[model samples]
Target chain A: MNLLLQLFLSFFQIGLFSIGGGYAAMPLIQAQTVEIHKWLTPLEFADLVTIAEMTPGPIAINSATFVGMRVAGISGVLVATFGNVLPSVIIMLIFAKLYERYSEQTLMKHVLEGVRPTVVAAIFTAGLSLLNLAVGSISALDLFALAVFVAAFLFANSKKITLSPITLLLFGALGGIGWEALGF
Target chain B: MSGKPAIDLKFYLKLFWTTFTLSLFTFGGGFVIVSLMRKKMVDQYGWINDEEMMDFITIAQSSPGPIAVNASLMVGYHLAGIPGALISTLGTILPPMIILTFVSIGYQAVAENTWIKAAFHGMRAVVAAIVLQVTWALFKSLAEKKNILPLVLFAAAFVALFVFKVNIMVVMVAMILLSVVLSIHETKKENMS
Candidate 1:
């Protein structure tokens, strides 16, 4: 298979099957990029994961762009990103159309009602995992992280503060640097 | 819906710009972008209400792709049309593409930076916090409905995922089927009355 075509097909399959979101897609991405296709080495894949986490956008898009660039430069980036996004565009458009058409129906309303709670639960779980990853264990809790979490949560919920997500993220970065400077 | 906004170039640009900026700063993952999107689309712009946003999110999560991109497509389509969807999707992707291009070039330097790692460490906590806030908000909204099913489903789903480690796809399908059955039962009861 041609390299670009291979990249496109691999990512397109990833896009099609990545059902639960970015985190769920990680193993699949790893398998294709590192093990199966050998597009990236294991060390490079790990670095890509870190970069993906630290950077903006979802992990899928970030990895696709990074791996694509490594494989084939700018054109690779475009092809892979496009492949990853194509399924999303198609699936979402269909869903959007169906939702618009059937949203008023009682059955559809109930279905949404049922799904919304699960979505909440999923988000909660994602948050917990992230917290666990960041803070490590309860016994060895990072006080700095805990404090930032508390402060950020407070600021986010406070009506008077009007803090945006970007500001909060910046604050997090600054706090980290400040903590490190203070020898913590 | 009445008073629908015209699908004009200005509207498309606004949609593009909104997703672009959101994508640019969105750390963590799909959920983080969602919270910011709610703030921008629902709170700041008044483009969509909380209920609609929640629906968009549910659909985005259930769809096959990045939730952020899926969400952008849904929102853009909802507000404008196909063209809006295309533009917003473009906006959501461009930032990551641009950033990663640079990062790929400087992979060694970035991968080895302690300061960057420290910043990310701090940012992770904030990301978790932001997600917690969003979860709470969604939970509160479901609570306000005064319905037991959603509440129960929420608890059950949480347990299923966190405790038992069931696959998400399985949980989603089961919940959808259960919802459909429950709705049918309710409809029958109403008809009887």
Candidate 2:
């Protein structure tokens, strides 16, 4: 299959199905791009995902562009990005008005309320898949990462201190820099 | 042009420029924006403060639509009105849009490199920790309500997806249907009494 076509179709599917946002899209995006297609290494994909999270726009959009660029080139990026965004853009443009009109209806309200928790579930799925991809085949580093995970988790859960993602990222980067400097 | 001068084209332009420039650098999505917006707007430009930025971020995430994009839009709109909103949105979107477009073009060849592979390995591990953190935060937020329904739904959904290998879409639809049935039944019960 043409690479551009593949990029387009894959990203289109990603955006169409993402439902909750970039976080929700992570698992499927990883499966399709990394596991099935081998378009990107798990790490490269992870890096791009981080960059996407850091940069503006949606994560799915950021991922689509990264994956698309990797596969096809500039034109490929355009196709893939368009594919990812097209679904949401078209849906918002077409349905926003209609949704607003009937948004107050009881059934619609209840249905959306039901779907909200599912969004969180979907996000959890994405987060776990990302964790698996990141911690692969390395016991010590994985354990260290796990320690950080437990620390961050307990800190947030028990202390309610909120170690924001940015804080963890800075600390992780500092750890990396420190390791590099130590030459261990 | 306005009498009060509290709101004007210059203020709108400044807001637009700030959002556009900040949007260019922020990738991934919500969390990155929190830091970057804090740095550029709060620290550098002094458009907002720590508390205001935090408030804006919380509001942006809770409201409908993409959090970063919405934040830019709301901030822009707040500063300058409709025009400010348009310019800010455009500014926020333009950088990543352009960079991603370029990157997508040559990403395949780039993905195959060796060092890229090694770096990504470490990066992925770090990202996993970050992701875990994201989930834990969400769970904590929801947990406080003591809503067993949501927790049950969460656990059930996880099992359906991981253990049963049931399709997520199918599970989502099932949950939605269940919620509707429950709502209707409750309404009917209330009416009968």
Candidate 3:
């Protein structure tokens, strides 16, 4: 198959398998782009991952766009993005019955109770991995990230000021720019 | 309270309308959608509740698609008929598809814009923060019960990803093994008791 076809097929499979949201799609996405298809270098994949996290849409959508752009330019972007989304569209349309039947199933409830923690663990792992990469082998910024993390943590628990995530993001970005300018 | 009348076309139309509009405003991800869906459907429309919503989330996650899409299908199927499911799913996804289409078209024009990039830089932190918050919430739910098996599996999965650099399939296999073993142990303990 052509690269475009492969990207489409692979991401379609991703869409088919990914449940919960785009974030749940990350492990498979990273594997396909970085390891399986070699569509992106690990560094590039990491960068793409960061970009996806930052973007407004779904992470799966963002990854599809990035990988598509990388592999086949604009055409690649369209194919992959569509491929990623198509499965959701098709499956939801066809298998709507499953959605109805399974929503109230007892087995599903138990399984989800089991899976929830694991999913949480996986996401936490993803966040930590991102932190590791963002700080590039862990120095003061690692600690700084941790402090910011704790602040967010405590604030969330205390129900204090509903600190806009946007504000924290601005501060982090300014800090990054300042450090770079200061040659840190 | 008097027993409410059974469903009607107007109810279906309202469900479809609410879900579609909700999709347009959902910026971050399904997390944002969760709260919004709760507010609109449960609080506003009295369609569902906290427990039912939790069930919706669980079912959506266990299924094979995006949670938003899955939720739409389920919610729509519940509200209306098969046609309702189709319409609701379409309504939920159509906006995002249209917006992304425009994004792909003009991607290059704005790709290098400084303000866009700066705003994105801010958004990244928000993503991380929100994801972390959700993860923490899940963690508390799981750990509160003190299920040693899942806790072990959680730690093992993390180590597998972080230390051994094992593949996700490997991690998944380990998780399955851990779950099966725990189930067997639980059975054995029950027999003993």
Provide C-alpha RMSD values for all models, in order. Answer: 6.7, 6.3, 5.3
lDDT of each: 0.79, 0.63, 0.63
Cand. 1 Cα-lDDT: 0.79
Can you give the lDDT of residue B112 in candidate 3?
A: 66
Query: Chain A in model 1: its TM-score?
Result: 0.58
Q: Which ten residues in a row have the lowest lDDT in candidate 2 chain A?
A: A95-104
Q: Identify the runs in model 3 with alpha carbons over 4 angstroms from their true place.
A: A16-22, A38-57, A69-104, A138-159, A177-184, B1-17, B38-58, B79-83, B98-137, B173-193
Consecutive 10-residue window with the lowest summed lDDT within model 2 chain B: B1-10
Tens digit per residue, CA lDDT, model 1, B1-193:
2234677878888888989999998776898899899998888888888889998998887667899999989888888888878898999999999999899988745755878667777777777777678778778998998879778988999999789877555676787788789889988898899
Model 3 — TM-score against the truth? 0.70
- Can you write out model 2's per-residue Cα lDDT over A1-184, one digit (the tens) per residue? 8888888887877765554444766766776687668988766677777666444577766777677666676677678766765554444433323433533345545655666666677667766766765554455356545554555455544555766555555565555445445553
The best candidate in terms of lDDT: 1
| Greater-DockQ candidate between 1 and 3 | 1
- The recovered share of true contacts, given per candidate in order, is 0.80, 0.37, 0.31
Q: Which window of ten consecutive residues has the lowest lDDT sum in model 3 chain B?
A: B118-127
Worst window of 10 by summed lDDT in candidate 1 chain B? B1-10
